[model samples]
Target: METKIREAGTGCGCPGNNAGALSSSTKGCCSPPDDVSGKYAVSCCGPESVTARPAGNQAEKRRLDIEFMYLDLSVCTRCRGTEKNLEEAVSEVARILEAAGFEVKLHKIHVQNEEQALALGFVSSPTIRINGRDIQLDVRESLCESCGDLCGEDVDCRVWVYQGREYTVPPKGMIIDAILREVYGGPAGAVHAPSKMEALPDNLKRFFAARRNKET
Candidate 1:
């Protein structure tokens, strides 16, 4: 599945690097704000420009990929919470990871509807995948009021079992553990796959279809 990609457009509502007037979407370590660009401009592979450095240093770069997949970050509490917690976890370990020669790259993907979700093998929303593997295994689904508001129907979201308790949102410690494990010889790579794909949950399909229709 391919994640949403936003092209650069003319404007001064951007930050850093291309602070001045620029042609269009300036890809970087992070995406432009939704209000600023309303586009998915950032790439998952860190930033676009890099200083000329030694090849030896490049070899030491342990690229840790992070993908926070969700239906709608603006509304879904679980999705929002998970994304924030994951970002914090990565931030907490970023310095250490860099010291250990690792670079952390995170991407927040918005799954438009059910079709996109299925194509991504997304069992539910607020799905956090590190290095192409879901941190929490065993896919399950449940009704989400937040999603319902957006889709105009009862949409299901994913759940996580943390410290013996089930949570609509994943615990910060869980994300920390996931990243730490990878740093300590965990066999893994980060996410590079596109979010949009051609894939299915029956109710989800209907819900997404309804959403698409409403938007159209």
Candidate 2:
């Protein structure tokens, strides 16, 4: 499939005729910020998507301050679909908020096992969370058998694919809507909690507990 390149606007600081830099692997894409100073940074990836930091005070005024967590495998087919949906959702939301003078955050949930999946009540791939809450309209049981169908492992799942490429991020409009929902206290959506076993290597139990408490 041919990858499309979208133009960036002045606000994004994109150069003429292009939104941002693209990977040589892909046609052209919006590049992430050179430096991510805070919790997040606004990235001008392409015309389809742009990442930006949440404008705390401004967002509060626009009432669009919320954190979005996306649950998906790093390389699962179905999970990729979910990621695409989320990316579109987030990108849309970002554009909306930007127009409204608001901001949002995009977070990635890397689930490793059934325990973590169960904790977040993930019924399907690419689960979305708003402020640690699940936002999927449907709820189903998660399945993990093998990955042999797609690649190395036996557990395999189908994700969304638009043009043969697994969208690591979503388009613009969806993101804006998500943020709007979160700001108004709609629901943080489903929360993907790391399992006891999936804890970070650098962090011991104590550290994990502390971080978990904060997230909760």
Candidate 3:
């Protein structure tokens, strides 16, 4: 069986070297904001780009690829809780997946700097993807004290919505639902095509810059 874990600096075959300083832009990360009464809040980031695919040959065995991307898992409560839920969800379904002839692979990615965040097409902290498809389509964010302290500036992290309710950390059932959807097609199994973007969102750029300055 083939499995691996990747850290931020290790390179994930993203296109080009660090683009250097990020430029100021009026563009927001995702689509335009809707009315406050709407079910979904305005997303903090743009549509996710398919930055990775399942590793290894599919002809050999069925494969399930899971990627957990985040910033500061150690201090960010949101990131830490999300990771824990993801792990438990995977464990609960592992045996059933194995019996059904599926091989599961999990990759934990830590976004350390601006260069890596840009390369990974990361717009928000604490993202989870299955087979390169984001579990939650809507990307909402709220102020994260932990991440803000880590970078020495105000920062916002992802907020998850499940069954019409918003949560700081994604529910375990939501993660399992996403994984099962990838494994077995259903009405909601439509795969969203990844979109292209030129630069990182200003929100993320600020976070990275603050982190770098503090470290130096």
Candidate 4:
């Protein structure tokens, strides 16, 4: 089969056409800020997908699936920063993985509502999963001013913990380490799959509800 890529929500209203500049007035969830180099842009107002096949016609190639799910890239600073870091990490490893006969696929999912969040088993805003496993298993969150402004209410976004240090935006090294571990294997008892959530977390529920109320 020929390699195919499908993307959705590529054209949701966002200021500056996905410019890197941060804006407190941006009105939607689909906007992804451009990186500093002006070379990378993620257009995700909804769910977006990309499948990159290895160069050469091989009958079959190993696949590496990466999913980035976020609540609001347009205004959520945490989400925007995480998205940038994730993209960088992927780019850094793309050539190496491709040369190793791995076909990389990335899915950028914008969780706009409670139902969507529940459906994706999303427990927090701005999550990264490699091969169906969350890069960080423990979910923690802190108040997000940008998102709070977007919805007219306070909201909590993800906080990444690496080596006992908490960061609002996940470090590139932490993401790279997770990817390498998934590809090359980690500790003997590492969790290889994401845990299922029965319901959307209350924090997310509040954010979604507040956003809906604001839009109406």
Candidate 5:
């Protein structure tokens, strides 16, 4: 199965970039927001463009080359672990597909308003989509951000309590595995590709893959 892709549209009642005008979406990073729209936009990589297929036309037959969109922001230091884990996972996948000679486009969602988040039906930050489908398996903990109270026993506003420990977020490995399962059309264990066995050139690569595998 292919992932779902979300595109930013014109004049969606959100803020505009520097020119004080509404600009179209750019790959890698989203345009800056002129006003706060209850959402955060992440600017990273460099400005590139990706073609968006109409939502109604997704079933057209084509080769299954993958395009990934990592919805995040630059100032999300509070969520760095989630972003780092996502970046590391994407890098490893890029290496694999690059070796296999398949092209992939990595885009960033610059959140400027609730519309953007709602556009993709995202429940929280650090959402990973292959094509456009959310691969993260677990539902995010519900927290009342405004009240600073746990929405449930283990669900705090921004933090999560999985077992005994309360954390700002879940481990990156767990999130990555969720995306892997969504992208590969099966559970991570079912694919069993030995992602760590792939020839990686750096510590982060091994670090993230090993962590993700451990989660699986």
Candidate 6:
């Protein structure tokens, strides 16, 4: 099967891209910034996904970071399920990514306030990001009864569309599809089973900004 790979991130190392530590470079990548602590500086941050290898290890090891951002995991069943979904997704192809010398790190972030959400560029709760980019960029903010009370009213939670079906929590396959895209970007086609990861929704940034302002 000819796997149609959908590339993720900004292809890395671009002038305008996030300067996270990664081995791969597209145009201009893998340069360490002078400042590592600043928000704009983009440090390796968490141990889950640092590109640097152990000193004297010799063998090249790539860092693959995955983050699952949610509003409040305790109050939201959907968000809780997403955590499991992500685990299953990563487990599906853990060896594939690892064999490619990728040290996989999975994390969960709780966005309790609007400020944190805005700062992190969170489109909605239950959002998943690989590297510094969203897995699926089509962010839908819909009323979630599960977390409505927690939001002080009816909260607009995140939604995902998988296999032509709408789901409150992302399907495991959707995440696997996304990981494959990042795993095999560009001319380096998929070495294993072919999978499809659809592109992000166009012009979603405008909505991200609009949503932030409206809620703030």
Pairs with steric clashes in candidate 6: 13-28, 13-29
Q: Give the clash count for model 2.
A: 50
lDDT-sorted candidate list, best first? 3, 4, 1, 6, 2, 5
Task: Supply the TM-score for candidate 1.
Answer: 0.65
2 or 4: which has the higher TM-score? 4
Candidates 1 and 2 compared: the better one by lDDT is 1
Estimate the lDDT of model 4: 0.70
Task: Write one digit per residue (lDDT tens) for candidate 4, span 1-216.
Answer: 111111112111111111133235563455565344434455565335222323333334566777899888788899999999999999999888767556667889988777777667777778887766777776777788899999999788888878877889999999989888866773322333434556766777898889889989
Tell me how far the alpha carbon of residue 12 in candidate 4 is from the true structure, in angstroms, after superposition: 25
Each candidate: RMSD: 17.8, 21.2, 22.6, 21.8, 23.3, 16.5
TM-score of each: 0.65, 0.38, 0.68, 0.68, 0.38, 0.59
| Whole-structure CA lDDT of model 6 | 0.59
Candidate-wise lDDT, in order: 0.63, 0.39, 0.70, 0.70, 0.37, 0.59
lDDT (tens digit, per residue) of candidate 5 on 61-155: 21122222222244333345555665676676665544433344455564433434444444444444444444433434333232222111211
lDDT of 1 by residue, 58-84 (tens): 233556767777777778887888888
Error of 4 at 22 (Å): 52
**Backbone clashes under 3 angstroms, per model:** 13, 50, 0, 2, 10, 2
Give the worst 10-residue stretch by lDDT in candidate 5. 10-19
Q: Model 5 scores what on Cα lDDT?
A: 0.37
